[model samples]
Target: MRITDLNPHGGIGANSLFVELGPFKVLVDAGMSPKHEGNEAIPRLDLIDREPLDLILLTHCHLDHLGAMPVALRNHPNVPLVMTPASRVIAQRMLHNSHNVMVRQREENGVRDYPLYRRQEIEQMTGRIFPLAPDNPRFFSSLDGDTMTLTYHHAGHIPGAAGFTLEYHHRKIFFTGDVLFDDMQTLPGATFPREQVDTLVLETTRGASGRPPGYSRDKEVGQLVQAIRETLEGGGSVLLPTFALGRMQEVFSIIHRSMGQRQLPRVPVFASGLGVDLCDYFDQIARKTKAVDFRRQILKDLKVQRLPHGYKPGQRLPGPAIYVLSSGMMVEHTPSYIAAVNLLGDARNLVAFVGYCDPDTPGGLLQQAAEGEYFLFEVLDKRAMLAARRMRFDLSGHADRDELLAFALDLEPRAVVLTHGDPEARDWFADQLRTARPKMQILDPTPLEPVEV
Candidate 1:
């Protein structure tokens, strides 16, 4: 058996991995990298153009994991795919939306374009995706009467996220698809059953540095609530720029729950744009998961609208409201741009960041802003404005140090291969793991770099 990476390893984006075991050729996640001039970074995987792939397995619906699905399917339309049921739904939405953006970006960037697949390609991808329900055993019959039993386990990173195990030819390989830390709020933590394994493909997004002992998601949220309350009591609006999914729902639920416990003031808590739709989506998901109160509260608050997409200053915000808007990183098109333009220079308003941001983005600039640096930010490409204090809190969706180490130690696999991380994070994790298990084989290959087992 062999595994190969097919894109650059550093910075975010363009994630593709190919695995081969006897006659089985499994292509894992294929994603777009930020470094790609446009959509060109979506790997061609032409190396396997002539080889027959047995299956394709998706980690989750994140663009970096499934961005190249359409292209892959166009090149090999008959290959079967597998993922969690909820991910299949999100994948279709995310991919179709991304394809639109890809087309526009390509045209704007003046990049050489090819005959890329269309929305129909996304539909075809969905049609072939066989749901691999958690803990259920399914057999993939081999050409020589040998069988591969595939199992999916909840990864606890997002709703419907999974870590999978494949038993083939008496060797077990465990794939951790974007594992999460114990601090996550919305989903349960990842579970790794003890099993003998030859290889463990893990993610090192949060494994480089160790977190302090005794950290709790509840404590973090409590501190954030206190901070928000202080800002609100001081007569300021709290501007939380968050991703449309995951952290957005987690933060909303946390704030709603805090209000229920009387731990928060009844500020006008609102979310703008597609964020409104996501709440409904979460409600539906929570219902399926038997989450009673969360679903009811989210459904009840469906009517509360925040400031709309293009509100300007002197145009008035909807009172002392707490606005949770989309495009978490304040990427140009999101509502955060509107808020930054309208709310800047107002010492009373606070822009609180909750996730990672690219350095080129407005949110990233806000995060890296110095103490005396005056930010001239713009919304709708209109007049720029200056802002006062901006705050950032690490409400990440990835696993922390202890959680990463715990996963590796608990699994006790024969070898470990790190993927979906930058070189620094990957090296840091591999170095840390060596101290605990010196004999374990650690592989961190560049895109298209293959490893044999």
Candidate 2:
């Protein structure tokens, strides 16, 4: 088997992989980088010009995985896109939203290459996509007339996320896209194959961090509730910066349940426009696919209001409101980032992060800032003191290092390839895997580099 890392910058952004098993050529998860602009943000699809792709498999609809699909489809016009049935609707909606964002950025940020792919192109590609039901083996034939079987497993990271297995020529390979082994408020834990494979392609997102002793999901949830309750009861607003898709829904579910149990004060819960839109989509997903355990009704019952407009930075917002906004990393121009500047100067408010934040992002910088240090918001030309409390919860959507290692070893694969992590994170996994079983082959392929398995 030949596998190449298609992500140009490597690490956690623009994740795409080209794998060849016997005669079958497969492209997994064409993605665009969040930190980059225009064409550079996308995967290096030029490398695959020599050979036409036979098929494309989408593990999930996260922007890093689904954002570049229309671009990839344009490159390989004949390739048929495949994904779990649950990802069908969300993928299209996300692509449309992405196009709108691109159009907006083209004007605001002066990114001339914005709207990389047209909406009509996405519509054309939609007709070619086929949704495969999970946990069932389906046969696909390559150009050379070789047959391969594909099966997908539920990956607990987010709604519609999946880990897939490939069987060809008596060799089996498994690919775990962003995965979470533990369950959350709105999703169940992963249910992957507990069998042997020839190769295991695993995500190393959390390889650098270990779960603290006595750390459990329930305990963390309890602590988060306690913090929010304390802040709200003290006449201070709480802001949770989260991703619009999965993290927003999960946090809402937690908040809703906590309020029902009378653990949280019933204050006005505010959400960004995208968050409110996703609630409807998630509701449809829950009713149609049952892939997630979310109900839009709860959000409505909680009185989740659309975030009010005409608010300027440094102005004190109406007190004791819980604001759930998007752009989890608090990127410039995002609702969360703008709100941060408004809320951070107040000693009474709390800004809590409920998901992973890349070290280079504004969210990470704020987390590392001292309580009294001044932080800069470059784009907005604003500066504020770190007066409000900032806290990070262990509500990540990826699996911990130990759990990932155990899963890789349990597969008993001959070779393992690490993806979706920073250099230090990947190095940690490489060291631990080598120490555990020196005979096993562990390959951390550099960007665009091919490795033979």
**Model 2 C-alpha lDDT versus the unseen true structure:** 0.89
Error of 1 at 55 (Å): 0.9
Span of ten consecutive residues with least summed lDDT in model 1: 290-299
Question: Which stretches in model 2 have alpha-carbon errors above 4 Å?
Answer: none
What C-alpha RMSD separates each model from the true structure? 2.6, 1.4
Tens-digit per-residue lDDT, 171-269, candidate 1: 889988887746365677776576668889888886556666766766777778887888788787888888876777777877777777888778777
Model 1, position 327: C-alpha lDDT score:
79
Per-model TM against the reference: 0.91, 0.97
**Ten contiguous residues minimizing lDDT sum, candidate 2:** 310-319
Query: How does residue 357 of candidate 1 score in lDDT?
Result: 82
Query: Total clashing residue pairs per candidate?
Result: 10, 0
Tally clashes: model 2.
0
